[model samples]
Target chain A: MDYTDYYKLTCSEIQKLYRENKASPEQVVDSYLKRIEAVDGKLNAFVKLNRESIDKQLKDLKEKKEKPLYGIPVVIKDNICVRDEETTCASAILKGFKPPYDAAVIERLREAGAILLGKANMDEFAFGSSCETSCYGPTKNPWDLDRIPGGSSGGSAAAVSADEACLGLGSDTGGSIRQPAALCGVVGLKPTYGRVSRYGLIAFASSLDQIGPITKDVRDAALLLNVIGGHDPRDSTSVNAPKPDYTKSLINDIKGLKVAVPKEYFVGGIDKEVSLYIGEAIKTLGSLGAKIGEVSLPHTDYAVSAYYIIAPAEASSNLARFDGVQYGLRSKAAKDSLLEMYNRTRAEGFGSEAKRRVILGTYVLSSGYYDAYYLKALKVRTKIKEDLEAVFKEYDCIVTPTSPTPAFKIGEKKEDPLSMYLSDIFTIPVNLAGIPAISVPCGFTKNGLPVGLQILGKPFDEETLFKAAYAYEQNTEWHKRRPSL
Target chain B: MVSKDNNNKKSEIDVGYVAKLARLALTADEIKRLGKQLNDILGYIGKLNNVDTAKVQPTSHVLPLKNVERTDKVVPSLRIEETLKNAPLKENSFFKVPKVIE
Candidate 1:
């Protein structure tokens, strides 16, 4: 296999190569380093590359016998804690905050012999839909430098798409991972909430958060999911359940499966190209002997509204810890009063988006308006979850265009927060309902940007979702096309 | 548009009250800005009133979790110095802050 292809090979292929001695751990690591050196400047995908430490780990792994992920290199979002590396979360406030301990997921990845490549840039506190909020600046799309890679996982997706890293770990809240993956033309999965441990992910909205894999193909996503998805005693919210064999079901045929296409998803404002490509994929599934039907998630229109309230409300609480007291950056000067110091520290530390949300969240959750806003949104959220549960009972899977449109220019929606929130309209409800959803590249737009078809499955049924997505991928040539990086 | 009655204090939630409850000491200009922004956002959210939610019970959490009881065992924590290393000001294993009650 070509050494460049070593960086793009499927997880299973890499494992086979390592087992058969056709490739060694050091060679695989070396291949990715050279690729990063050669191409990363143009892509701007990585915020930090720990070449020396990762090489040391690879040398140690090579000395030992074969292990799971023995030679595989994986990149992590900058927000997720990896000991000794700066976990900036792409914010100036956290510029030099090196974590002293590994996040729960990082420990697992390290134990599995996976090489920690580096930290990928993200939206500050994983807040923005586009990666433009980063203190380092926006991560440009590898396919077209002028366009943006969908964010807050944009760097993670861009790195994988540009072949700078084999696979990347990203946190998804309100479609952060899947939307960017769709926009960047890669596979991104938001595992069922609580399916993966959230002990180390810097909080965006604690309730909606999940750590998942972004990769080039479905099976690698499944394999990474298998490695990362499991309960941790440290995380109180983790689900105590056995992990299913995610890779075993990827090859299963989708004949006679019931797929639901919600009518509300096909409404106005969805780009014509996205709708057309997703419609073609649906028709292709129908031709392959699967039963397709129209279903209504009537409460979906309220999803974006409900998401903003709950996510920010939870965010305001989760972020209160960074009060210039316990961790992260602190203000420099002393003040006469504690309150004045608090305000000054916060005003200087947090970015614009973070401050705006904190103010809104605090207002909504305050004494008088708690029942009017936060409580009411939570009630609406219940109905939204119920709506999906009702539909899932009748259909095995739900399909929709992953994003309303293709990757937009970097600064297009930055000024208008409402418009930016609408970008994740289709993907937010899945996170709200805590279901497994994956974004797979379906087709390219007229401008040559990738459009994705989102496939959502019942809770913990990632196996079935992967089978259908893999089947759809097999019928089309979209996954074979690579960005001319 | 709904008319404001002399006794319509319930419908007219003042920004000052909201700010005070939120512990935000806003200036006149800040309050005006927040007032307009909140009104616009609240108007958009007001659309939810059109739905027939009278019969529905309020739902707080999506997952049907109950008794998420942990073992209550103490796990090892990061070294106090390491954890507090990022603090802006610290002394004697505690985060240093100005006196609150003096």
Candidate 2:
């Protein structure tokens, strides 16, 4: 196989190559490093590349192939902490900040022999829908330099797309992981909220954030999921459920599987091209012997609104620690009162998007408005969850266009926060409901940008999701297409 | 007919009050900018009131999951010095904070 093709090869294939002596772990890491050296300048996907750590991992893997993920290289969103590595979340506030220890997920990945590539750029504090808010320049879509790679996992998705990395770990609060995976034409899986540990991820929206995988294919996503998903005492929210063999069921045929297409997802506001592609995917599944039905998630229309209120409310609280004296950037010359020092420090440290959300969040959570906004949004959020439960009872899985549109020009929605949030309209409901969801490259728009079909399942039912997504992937050529970087 | 107005905005809200609640010490320009932004976002959110939610049960969480309790046993962790070393400011093994009051 061509060297570039090795970049797209799944974890299963890479492991086989290692077992058969056709490739060594060192070669895999070296190949990816060379690719990053070649293309990362154009993409700006990575903010830090820990070549030394990765080289040490490769050497250890060669000495003993003891771990499940031995020698597999993975990229991480800048928000997820890896000890001694710069975990900036692409915010100037955290310019040189390094965590003292690994995030729970990183610990798991390390135990499994996965080589940590480096921190990928993200929207500052993972607060924005587009990666443009990153302190490091925005990660451009590898497929089209002028267009964006959807974010806040845009850098992770872009790196995976450009052959800089084979697999990536991303934090999804709202649609950060899935949206970028769709735009970049890679696969990203957002496990149910507590399925993966969140111990050391820089908080964006604590209730909504889940650490997930961004990989080149479904099984690769599954393998990474197995390595990362589990309970950790360090993370109070981590689920206590037993782990399942996600890869063991990927080849299961999705025949006779009941997939629900919500009417709200297909309403007029969805992009014409994206809707057409998803409609075709539904038909393709039908042809492949899957049962497709129209199911109503009536409260779906309220997803984005509820998300804005709840996510920001939590974010406002979670970010209070970044006050000058604790960690990250502090204003050196502020001679005013202590409060002034705090404000000035934050003002200097955070990007525009982070400040915008902080202001909005504080407003919503204020004493007088709390009941009307924050509490009310929470109640609506409960209804959204109930709505999903009512629908899941009648279907084996749910399907929708992962995003409203394909990749747009880099700065298209930079100034329009509402428009940017709308791009995640379809994907947010899954997070709100705490259900497992995956975005797979189903097709491309006429402009040649990729479109993703979202597959959602009840909590812990990732096996069914993998089965359906794998079946669809096997029948389509979309996943086979590489960005002409 | 007796009823309570759910849409009433608390009448005491002023620029400084809102700014304080938002952790912002605003300049004249910021106060104006925020007043307008808050009003606009609030107006947009007010649209949620149009839904006939009288009989609808307010939903707060997605899962019916009650909080699971773990035994309150402590596990050994990394050394305090190691964990606190990266704090921007630290004194006596605790993260130092700015004094808010005399």
Candidate 3:
């Protein structure tokens, strides 16, 4: 088989090739490296390519016994640490910072025989909805080079969509993974919060952030999640629950499954084309014997507002550790006074969006305002969670459009922060509710940009989400369509 | 309590104060621009006020587990040299910082 054909193979297919001795892990890594070198210049998908580490992993594979994900190449979001590799979180503040230890997910991937391909770019500190805020310039959508790939996990999504790597791991805090996966035309899943360990994921929102897989198709998402989604002692919030073999949920049968289409999600401001695709997807699911009904999640209007408050408030506290004394970029201009040094180091290191969120977070959590803002947001968050739980009582899964629209032009929403925040409106509620959600390509717009159908399930019931998503995916040709780069 | 109408005025001063608390130095232009952006975002989030959460408990975490403590055992951890390797300025296994309490 040609090396070019290797780039097009899914994780399962690659494993099959390895079993047959048709391709070596070295050749697969070389093919992807060459593809990244050829196409990443245009897509800007990868922030730092770990060439030496990848070569070392390839050599190490010769001594390892057969394992799941054997010989498959995987890309990790820049925020997730890999020992001795630069995990910048796509921020200038964390530039040149190499972690001394590997993230829990990285350890799992290595144990499963997956080679680390590279670190993909992202919104600095995962603060923005679009990839445009990266210290490394924005990653372009593979389908339409001029459009922005939906983000903070945009680079990971773009890399998987462009086949720069077989599978990409992305941390979704308020739709970072799913939104970009929607825009980039790939499968992105956010496991139930705490389902996957957050040991080395650079904190964006500790309660909300989840590391999941971005892949060319749903089965690959399941395969990658099977390896990475489990309990870890390092993350205190890691759920001490039995980890199931996610691959078993890939059965393409959704007969008699109850699916809910939330009326609030489709009400207004959604692009006509996106709504049309979602409508078609719903009908297709119904055709497959899944009973679909309209349900109302009344507090959906408050989800975005609540998410912004909670995520940033957590971010403010989490990001405090980035003070120059410990690690990362430090400002040389404030050598006069310690206070001046602390101030200058942070201001110079962080980007505009990071600064904005920190200020907002600090203000909301400040004295006298805590009740009206931070505390109130938390209360509203409970209401949103209740809303989803009520629907899930009768429905196995809730489906919605992953994003309001298809990929917009790169600079379209950069100037308007509120508009940019709206990009994650559909995906944010799942995070605020801390439920499992997966975004799968449903259809394309007239301009050929992909539209995502989001399937959300009860917490720790990712098996149900995989079942629903896999059924719909098998019935459609959307997942097979690749972006012509 | 900052009123909704006075929120914009409060934001002007609040942005500066919050930046100070965050230990982030902001130039006059950045402060001015960020003040407006923060105000805009805060105003949008003001929609959360509509919900009546008098009976609802604040959810710090969705999971049922509490106080996930491990056994107090000494384990092999990162070496001191490895821990300080990423520090921008270091002095013999210690992170170097600007002089304080001078």
Candidate 4:
């Protein structure tokens, strides 16, 4: 049997191989490394590989093979810090910056014996959805190389979809995780706000970002979540909620579960085929003994506007730290007014999109515009969240098309940023509402692009999302279909 | 000249002034291109004013905010060298910047 086929094995299947002594950790890691070398040139999924640390991590795992993820190789989005590793967030400004300490999730993953791969590419500071904003280049969809793997977690999703890694950890501010996961034909879970610690994640939006799992299957997502979820004393915003054994939620029974199809999600501009696929997926939920019906999130249209304002406002403040000061790139300026040093350094470091967000954020939060734009957006955020909460009160979870359209051509929306922003119309509200949403492979388009079924649950109730997603995934053949790379 | 906009009108939102506030040295071409793009986005963000948020409390954090208190005891931290390792320029334990005082 070819070792290449080993790349196709899901996380649990690989673990089963380990249990049966059919393959060793060295063989598994070698297969994945080889697969990455063969395909990553086309996909551009990873920014840096921790090749130097692999042998050491594998050797260390032997000492504690009892760990849950012992020897499991996981790719992380570039934004998440790994101790002494370059975490550039695919931005030139942060290039060559090696963090002194590991993020909280990295600590947990290491303790659980997960082998960390090199960091995945992302939209520079996670500012864009198509992954094109990265200085590292865009991650091509494994399904269709000419198209984008939806981002800013595009690289993580593409890596998992293309079987370059057993699993991936991606931070979602809006639809970064789930959108890419859907487009790449994998499972992407965005846990509730503060559900996962953000200590090591390079902040895109303080209130919006949450680190979650992107994997080949639902159970792997739940497995990784169980390992990373729960409180961290290091992160003040980390929720004190009890972390449940998410694997238990994989029960095939969604029987009697109440699911709502939000009317706002099904509105115009959504691709016809995408809507049809989501409808069929909802029917699959009903066939599995779950009750599915339509509900309305009235202020849904205002979500993207609110998000554009709020995220950038927070981003402007959060990114003020990147003034070529303590770390990362420092430009050469002969005349040193200190202020000129800052302006020159920043001018050279940040990409166009980063600069755009910072400037927009500054504009909105500026004294004259603060109450009108920034504060009003915050109020609209309340309205959007209330819309979802009102629906959750009557439903177990909400289901919709993860993205308005499937994977699109690389330069398709690049000409118009507003149109590109609209691609996230469905997924953005979930982030603003700060709820848990999982994107699972529902079906494919006529052009063979995968459709994502977004299942959103009330805050911290990831169990319901897993149960419904798992049931749908188990009953369908969509998740099993691999992209012919 | 940019004026304080009481209404969410496209009140000459100066990308140049805002760029200065953001501490970015954007080129003239960038300022022009980014100005147009930002105005286009701001036009869309104008939708927020349509929502009657008359009495609604704004949600800054999705989760309720609470101060996390800890004992003031000092804990072990990164050594000075380790802390300064990532600094682009440093002298001794302090970060080195260009002359701040004229």
Residues B27-87 of candidate 2 have per-residue lDDT tens digits of 6766666556545555555655554555566555444558767798888778988777667
Backbone clashes in model 1, listed as residue pairs:
none
Ranked by TM-score from best down, the candidates are 4, 3, 2, 1
State each model's TM-score restricted to chain B.
0.74, 0.71, 0.84, 0.87
Q: How much lDDT does candidate 1 score?
A: 0.83
Clashes of 2: 2
Question: Fraction of true contacts reproduced, model 2?
Answer: 0.37
How well is each residue in A20-116 modelled by candidate 2, as lDDT tens digits? 8788776787788888988899999999999767766766665548678888888999999899887888988887787888899998888898988
lDDT for position B78 in model 3: 86
Q: Evaluate all candidate structures by whole-model CA lDDT and list the values in order.
A: 0.83, 0.83, 0.90, 0.90
Report how far off residue A121 is in candidate 4 (Å): 0.6
Distance from true location, Cα of A189 in model 2, Å: 0.8
Each prediction's RMSD over C-alphas, in Å, is 2.8, 2.8, 1.6, 1.5
lDDT by residue (tens digit), candidate 1, B1-102: 011221323243366665443444456765676566655555566555555665677766656777778777888888888988777778999988877886
Of candidate 2 chain B, the 10-residue stretch with the lowest lDDT total is: B1-10
Q: DockQ of all candidates, in order?
A: 0.40, 0.38, 0.71, 0.71
Binned by DockQ into CAPRI classes (incorrect, acceptable, medium, high), candidate 2 is: acceptable
The 10-residue segment of model 1 chain A with minimum total lDDT is A62-71
Residue-by-residue lDDT tens digits, candidate 3, A1-485: 79766898898888888788888887888889889988999999999888778778877887664788888889999999999999899888889999999999999999989989889999999988789999999999999999999898999999999989999999999999999999999999999999999998989899899999999999999999899988899999999899999999989899999999999998889999999999999999999999999999999999989998899899999999888988898998988788999899898999988988888888888887788788888999899999999999999999999999999998998989999998889999999888999999999998999999999999999999999999999999999989888
Off by over 4 Å in 2: A2-5, A62-64, B1-16, B25-38, B55-60, B63-67, B72-74, B90-101
